[model samples]
Target chain A: MCGIAALQLKDPALRPQLGSMMHAMLCEIVDRGPDSAGIAVYDVERFVHAGQSTVTLLDSPSSDEELSAALAAELPSAGAVEVRTLGDTTLVSAAVDTAILTAALRAVAPGARQIGRGTHVANLKGVGNPVDLAETFGLASVSGTQGVSHTRMATESAVTASGSHPFTVDDDLCLVHNGSFSNHATIRRGLRAQGIEFDSENDSEVAARYLAMRLREGDDLTTGLENLRETFDGFYTLVVTTADGLAVLRDPIACKPAIIAETDQWVAVASEYRALVDLPGIETANIFEPEPGEVYTWEF
Target chain B: MGVLNEEVVDLHVSTVRELNSALHKAHDGEHWRVTNPGGAHNVAVGIDSEIDVVIDGHVGYFAAGMHQKGTVTIEGSAGTGLAENMMSGRVHVKGNASQSAGATAHGGLLVIDGTTGARCGISMKGVDIVVGGNVGHMSAFMAQAGRLVICGDAGDSLGDSIYETRIYLKGQARSLGSDCIEKPMREEHLAELAELLAAAGRTESPSEFRRYGSARTLYHFHSENSSAY
Candidate 1:
């Protein structure tokens, strides 16, 4: 079992409390998953710089200086590159075309794994206690309007930094999963034949890639999730975050556990209610479990 | 009886063992109050005697699981497998519940004041589940006995491969599974449903519901039924 928690503030006034609230939620579910933890923060102002693309990297073999030099040589048109280290991941922000910069970074640091590329989303993940990982990344102090976090138990693939959760396949898009996919291999082969590359052997990564492909083809968030329902086979409770919204979806069978508690100020989705019990205004929130095959989305 | 006071245990400060031990040691008709459950899993499980347990906050998985002869009430939402495999007595949740709320339960009354997630009564052998709100997909799957009363909507595939478990739905059903057909509600069914509603503290009229059960088409395998299979 894995623990997944997501929060989207309906009012921007609550953005400052997002990190601490998410940290508290993750701590409640530490027993559900103790192998690894990850969080993707979408602070519109802090993480996302104007005219710049932020890329998160995991297991970087090169130091910041070497990586910066390589990026400069690969993309001469790109501006200065700034890198911040957090645990095993690095956040790189540069004023350049996102696609070009992503490709250049991939080539320069072949040993480094890309976590996500976007304007607002910055992800940090590692193998350890979720609480300690949160502290290491200063999650309680980082401010964000919306975010998604996960604590993984490693049911399908090896437990490593590359295999950790909060897998992002597109700009400002990330997915955290709580269950296994039954037909991922078949779908993975299909995507590969269509020229889509994968970074991990995780089933949830395939789902993120599938949704990203759909979104890239101009499908809306709701339609992409609906298509996901038709194509994927498994028991999953997914918390998907985008540039403007957050969504919660369960498999058609609804085997996995998920709860949604919403108040006037925010919407929170977690694998269990205890994760939300401590949230502000939870006592009066309208809490319910999302129905199977239904995508519940809240746009910021 | 006049001198005995109701026992109160705080889950925030006391262990589950302490609360359960008190229940196990209490005599018949003893009342216990559990405060600050904080959504802990497996609370108040395996009770074998007639008693009363009132939990003041949310509970996690398997709350009142394998229960017997105890009336347990949760004031907030429950995690998966609430009252699972219960053999007797009544278990009630005042708020929404997670998946498998009454899975495989036998001989008990499980009531939810709000909605319940998928597989609410899956694989139930003998139990009566009454939900004030909606029930998720695959509810009552492979049920062998007892009844399920849903006051609101039911998600996809209600009563798949069910046997002898009478389902009464007051609201819409997305769809029914194979061999599970909606049957006409008769006078006897109305009376039975009325009793169940009363037991669940609901005031809805039984005539508003429709009954569903097995069509007996898949009960026996034969060459003629090969295509159906």
Candidate 2:
């Protein structure tokens, strides 16, 4: 089993405490998954900025200055590249399109494994206790508008950084899964025929790639997930974060656990109630489980 | 609420093991007030005494599980497996419940005031489950022996491949599982339903509900009917 804790702050005042709150929620669900973990934060100013694109990679071979210099040289039009290290991941921000930025980074750091890329997403993950990984990433001190986290139990793949979830293959679209897909291999073959490359042997990575392909084909977040529901068969409880909002979906049987809590201040979803109990207004929040085979979306 | 001889145990201040140990060794007449549950799993589990417990907040998985003799109440919603394999007791949930609210319970009365997630009472044995609100999918799948009373609607597969269990549904079911069908209600079933409603503090008439049970079609496997199994 895996664990998930995602929080999207509606009130601007609550943004400053996004990291701390998600850390608390993640800590509560750590017992569900202790093999490896990942987190994604959407902070406009910290991860991405106005008219700029951001991409994070796990363990780049070059230093910050070297990577930044190479990226700037590769695409002179993409000016002023900034690179910083958090945990074992590196965050690179540039004033250019996400495609252009990521392409340039790929040319410069060919061996680096990209984990997150978008206008407002930062990803960091590792193979250890989730709380320890959070501490290394300074998750408690980071500020953001929304955050999604996952702790993996490693059913369909090896315990590697690339296998950790919050799979941000698409720009500003991060998806975390709590269950495995049974027919993913068949779907993976279909997606591969469509030229959607995968980075790992994990089943959840197949879902992330499938969603990215759907969004690229003009499917909205909810519709992409709905299409996935009809295409893939298995138990799944997913919480996906995009540039503008968050959405949650479960399989028809709904064997996996997911509870959603919503209020004016925030909208939160977790694999268990233990994750949401520490929120500021959770006692008064309207909490309910999402209906099976239904999609719940919240736009910020 | 029992101030005369009530003992308040705050989960924040004491460990869950400490609380369960106390409840297991407590006297028959003792009343306990558990505060700040914080959705912790296995809170007050495996109790074997005639004690009264009231949890002030939400609980995690398997709360009041394997209970022998106790009256445990949750003021908030409960997580998965609210009271699995309970020998004897009364568990009350004031809010909604997650998946598998009561699974394989040998004996007890579990009452949920709000709606529940999927598989509310799968494979129950000799327990009585009363839901004031709707139950989720596969509410009583393969239930061996029990009485399930649903005041609201039921989700998909109300009782799949059930055995000996009696189901009383007041509202609609999305779909019925194999070997489970609506049975004609008679006088004894109505009387038993009325008593169950009263035991759960419900006021709905027994006539308003519909009874369901196994058709016994798949009970004895045969060569000609082997495909259904």
Candidate 3:
């Protein structure tokens, strides 16, 4: 089983302090999922577009100098691609003509679009252990107020870093799933008909894309989550991180476990309470298992 | 004797391994006094020797799960699935029990003093269970072989698709499933009820009980009985 940890900091100063806490929470659940770990922080002011937008990943791990040069070079035709580096991995966030960025990144590197972000976007996955990804991208010390992190077990998908979780849809919403999607094939076909693109053949991405499409159609995160819970048939506990807040939802059967612990300072969610074991004042915290079919939302 | 009136063994422990190990050492033909058992799962699980293990408070899921060859008693309400999948042994609860009590149990005795939730004794194999208060809906559903004795009213669809299990109730059942029916009480049944009542620690007369069992018409699947599925 894969493990997911999402922390919504009530304090802005604590926002940057989240990198260690996210690392701390994910490290505790190392046993649940040990393959690869990834974290995504959404700076809403940076990655939104007014009209038609295109998102893609930069192929090569760009240096700070190389990234600034590329941004300076691409900004004339491309609308805006926000640049944020976790360590060695630099995420160039952009919303432009899909055809334009697609041509641009491919001309620079053959597989550039493989690491890209788009409209209705999400970006938190890697190819190895959380430590390796943290080292490779410099996430061990990075922090943000609201984000989602996942360590993968790789049951359905191959054990590649890209197959690890917190899958993003279009770039606005990111979802981490604990259980399998029973009706994934049917939904995948339906989305394919509706012109949704996919990278990997994982059910979690399909789930994320479905929710992202719903959110894009003017549904709030909570409403989109409820729709996903109603439409999707299986045992899944999903924690969705968006620009405004985070929403946690569980399937009706509740075959999977999702625990919630909250304090006046922040609200933390994990597959088990053991993930929150290291947090101070945990003994006095109001912790509980999330009820089946309930949507729990925490705004950052 | 010491100055203390009684010795209380505080079983305020963590982990299933620790709790079960302490119970084995304490229950050696002496009355073991325990308190503050806060929601421990599988407390009396796999205990096959004859001893009285008394718990002071509530228990978590599967408290007396799979018990055999001993008597385990609980003082307060139990979480989901108490005495689940138990084999021969006795589990006596003084308080209420959650859903699926005695579920799929084989060759044991489960006695509940209060109400049992939905699907109580569901798919029971051969265990004998007696409930003092009302039982929830779908009790004895898919039951294959066992005896369920209820003193209070039974909820909807009682004995749904039950197989060789015998059912006795003092109050009314909402409905009976296919192949299950109310039957006339015989002298042999009255004798069996007397033993079950004595085991459950009840002074009530056995004649108040009514017997229910398979009609045997559904021993084999027929096209006419296909609707039961």
**What total of clashing residue pairs does each candidate reach?**
1, 1, 20
Ranking by TM-score: 2, 1, 3
| CAPRI quality band, candidate 1 | medium
Residue B58 local lDDT, model 1: 93
lDDT, model 1: 0.89
Error of 2 at A63 (Å): 1.2
lDDT of 1 at A3: 93
Better model by lDDT, 1 or 3? Answer: 1
Write the residue-wise lDDT of candidate 3 on B95-176 in tens digits.
7776789999998899999887667899999999999988877889889988899999887778988888889899998777
Over A27-145, each residue of candidate 3 has an lDDT whose tens digit, in order, gives 76666788877676554233334453434353355664575467547656554556555432445545465556555655554554443355433364566667666555545466556
RMSD of each: 2.5, 1.5, 7.7
Error (Å) of candidate 1 at residue B166 is 2.0
Top-TM-score structure, candidate number: 2
DockQ, prediction 1 = 0.76
> TM-score of predicted model 2?
0.97
The list of candidate 2 runs beyond 4 A from truth reads B227-229
For each candidate, what is the lDDT? 0.89, 0.91, 0.72
Candidate of highest lDDT: 2
Better of 1 and 2 by TM-score: 2
The CA lDDT at A88 in model 1 is 85
